[model samples]
Target chain A: MKRHLLAVSTAALLAACASAPVVEHSKMTGAEIAQIDAVLKRDFRAKGQAKMTRLEPDAVQRECNLHADNPPDSVARSLQEAQLKTIKYPSDSLLGDWKNGRKIAESGRGMQWNEKPANPGGGGCYNCHQLSPQQTSHGTLGPSLKGFGKTRGYGPDMQRYAYGKIYNAKAYSACSHMPRFGHSGSLSEQQIKDLVAYLLDPKSPVNQ
Target chain B: MLVSGRSVLLTAALTLAAGSAAAQSQFEKYQKMVAEGSPVELFELVGEGLWKKPQGPKNASLEQCDLGLGAGVLQGAYARLPRYFRDVDRVMDLETRMLHCMMTLQGRSLEEATKRLFGNADKPSEMEYLSAYVAGQSRGHAMAPGQSHPREQAAYELGRKLYFYRTGLWDFSCASCHGEEGKRIRMSELPVLYKPEAARPLIATWPAYRVSNSTFKTMQWRINNCFRQMRTPEPVFGSEVVNAMNMFLTVTAQGEPYRGPGTKR
Candidate 1:
């Protein structure tokens, strides 16, 4: 039945492609993206913390959208370099308490319109990446961080990498799906350092 | 087809639960139990009453309202919706068309009609009940939304682009979670909605009764909540983006038998 459904839709899509007077590529054109932007501006109203400005894509986002999230290597590298400059490294230790990190990792709340601006938001780490061996409900969207410290040695360089990655994931991968926690002000320096400890601390369950 | 349908559903369920067979089966068992005792029929009955009830300025029922079929036709009407309406000169989904009916046939103002578009467990809205009733009327009919119309084609194109168009604080698009198969967000498997196989069962059972929230949800509400989660501004109800996304999903799953207003976790 699944195969039947697949065949039917494939045939339909093919027919649609064949019958078109002008062959249009599946990639989004600039005008169409602009049209979508226009529609969003016209159709979406500001609610709670979600402002009309959220509709506007940043430079990295614009390039990602134009290239379908697979920008050219040179462009992506340059974008990554530009993004790296945005992260603010704390002058002190990169790692914070992992116990606090556990709470942040478990939480999936933050930056949503329903949330209050004054209240501290969660890292929502468990929503995408597995951390400890105990939490089986973790998501598979990101690579698992179980035994993270064990696999990658618990060095200062690793801690710095973890902190920077958590701060702005796009600094490493230009079109990454992960949010820019520090850059976007979703997670503070302390919150990011705590998350770094959650992954890299020897005593953390992630290393167990 | 019914036997095959059940198997297809099972296959999809098991595919989602690839790593944990035991947990998946237990979840499936819970789902079956929930479906058995669903209050969907109650919502449908209430909807029927609302459909027949006389209200608004004209004080006329929705019986005269045409749902892309001739006036008063109910059977199989939903299966072919989000279609282009000649009278309105737009591609409208079920809720959109129903809103048009409330204004035209019953002479209700747009503000009055859409005041409580979404409802909670304690009190489901008129739109929720009405969607259940109308969608139930198309149970066995093949899912066939509009595609031939130039506007519909444009909507589909827009929807396709929107799926991959990453924006917002999280830089998340629909593709962030749903672009890949065999991925999940905290145990809930994200369906790769662009794929026909993934979309078939998912799209077939929409405007569903959500057990977790104890609320009946429409496709429009579904899209609305997703954007909210994406940390973006709220989309106006029944807008082109919402309808266009619906168009993309429905068109992708065309020819699947309508098996909802369904039960969901």
Candidate 2:
């Protein structure tokens, strides 16, 4: 088992820690950043959907860079506040099909330079969070979100929560690691509403 | 727990190869530039400051915030997580534990806490920075997340069962990519969760700093993202399933040195 092997390595790593010549990659300096950026600009070419702008950081990214991601408290609050304004709550009070939502969440084929512009994109949720009772093929960058409706309750409040969270995680957490799905139009309002239904509908597999 | 597997490493290698090969030379150059200075350092600094700052509802700092290592102590606690919490009566990881602290000490509502499970601004929820800071403390310390409690043990077992349970259009499980090794996709390496050796190095590294985003990533976010990729529904925050997966991962990591809040490509 992997756990057993890890135990052995831990012991060995510790045993050799004392006199093991430490070898770690050296960090890049500011000059390196500029030099690399130059090479990147020269080598990068624009493509469909995935454009040259993909490399460009928006305002928040620029601030994160200027402040090294730990923006001043006031700055962080303001940035987050600014981000919160970007969320658009649906007026239709809709919940699209969960069955369809499931398909959207599972698909990871989109956004690549080669992806056709006409191709509908995938949400790639499983790459970061656990979602189903049966699925094993998943990632852990984000938290497991099983039993979403059971835990959060299938109320309008919960519905809004799902919509907002998926719409723009940063609006809630200014520096959230989650991509701004709807805010950036990576997903559509209709799609986000379906995801909400997927998480909050009692009959949805998430609750079932 | 349903998400555990060795595919991460394989995926990483494949992603690495594909990304390296498919990515234009400029993209690689940009990645190299981005990798510079390891933006995690900033979050680490923020976390260090938050560690001792006293500002909770109890008018207390997280200085006494016990991350399962007795009160006010945080040395080498990273790799020993996903343990039982008497308060919640469940196993919690670093982010969940911090949520409890923020609630009990800082008087935050569950809504206020989970409101930003992903991460946010000035209120930069303690999850990411705190997790990064905590993991950083135990950097190089061997992980020994002892699942001595009955619940901890149960969570691990349940997580294992979930890991192998498969259903979907693809009939895929966590084992699909992770069960195998040396498989890759784009420009990343998949650490084999089934292999403790693979899981150990990473279990504690989360709440990691991402160069692309220049921000800290929490375990919850990581878990949530996986579900997104699986095309499954998102897991609720602080749910049993999330904690079980945490326990499973932590259990497998039972002796790998914790080195996190570390830089990730």
Candidate 3:
């Protein structure tokens, strides 16, 4: 394992050396980091609600960028463990308003630079996967989650998975197209519950 | 004293390093390729041949169908869809409207055609190819959805109301990301729909060929996705609400050119 890591780092180092200006530090130097920030600030205009801060990568993000999306196995496992620890399940049962779930899944609005600060957001799940039978429009970024509850069984374990997955997909698959709903504060607790009900409720069109 | 402190700090750092190495990589590659000329061109051919070819009960072709462009006119029709039809009156997006056309013109069962919309090129599942073909026809036309009819006007008004209507777990409305220009999440540009110029082109480009998924996606499919993002109740199939939303967006994009079997990231 150590040898493989060494090989990867070596390859990265070699690639870096061959590419352009030499990078001397394992970590970005203060000047280098500052320069990148300055460049972005100059180039990207801040619009309505969209701000320059969106470009800033947190520590975890920085780590992820350092490695390729498929970082070493140890790295994936560790990050997942850390992510899993952050999830907070509801004390009550997982069911909510499926009608609301329909609305949430169908909605593609939220968090725009021009969006009113008080208005909530949409999950934009349909942008990636198939969820309900009725709605024909949807994106293909993620897997079609139709028959989610029927196939998985809308039992306790699954309820947890749906809720948790909606909350933070990184906990399950370190690199899932499904958003980090809770982590990013994109969806609230009740909204997550409603999404769960949408997928798990037998009466919901998704299962039907 | 400085050297002693440095050694202790180094030891602590090494010890802690053993614990935090489990992070995954953030791929920048996916972001760079957005809107890099869609690969739907290949699917366009497959769809075109299927358009006039007949296999259903009526032994007819989709050539005489009206996709919101009067009858038998294929030019720039794909983009101004999901509007109100006088005979049908009710609003319908591309897939549902096509289902009506195939049922009436091609004599296929609604079940067969409806099921075909989401899947591959198997029997009774030609919507994918058909959509690709139809979408290909208006590849570069502007979004010129006409709202001359009263029903069309009504649908547009309803859709406008729906676009801003916030009712769901998250209280999300369509205007959240798309209402604003210059907003992108994780490298995906969220086009502003309030601006007709921006919304029209995108609306016109659906029934696009998604290369990564290798499937044809209708505008209804795109709206369904927006619903997913909104965390709201999934709309019913061929429901008026869906039509209403389409009319809303279509009218907003009234004068933009048409383009379809559009390539999406």
C-alpha local distance difference test of each model: 0.86, 0.64, 0.63
With candidate 2 superimposed using the best TM-score fit, by how many Å does residue A88's alpha carbon deviate from the native? 37
TM-score of model 2's chain A = 0.78
Worst 10 residues of 2 chain A by lDDT: A18-27
Identify the CAPRI category of the predicted complex in candidate 1: acceptable
lDDT of 2 by residue, B60-168 (tens): 6777778888877788766667788887787887777877887887676787667666665344556677776777887767666646789888777656644543322
Estimate the lDDT of model 1: 0.86
Which sections of candidate 1 miss by over 4 Å?
A1-26, B1-19
Better of 1 and 2 by TM-score: 1
Candidate number of the best DockQ: 1
Model 3: residue B216 alpha-carbon error in angstroms: 2.8
The DockQ figures for the candidates are 0.46, 0.02, 0.02
Candidate 3 chain B, poorest ten consecutive residues by summed lDDT: B18-27
lDDT of 1 by residue, A7-112 (tens): 6686466434432122122456788778888988988999888888888978888888888788889999999999999989999999999999999999888888
Query: Alpha carbon lDDT of residue B210, candidate 2?
Result: 66
Q: Each candidate: fraction of true contacts kept?
A: 0.69, 0.01, 0.00
Candidate order by TM-score, decreasing, is: 1, 2, 3
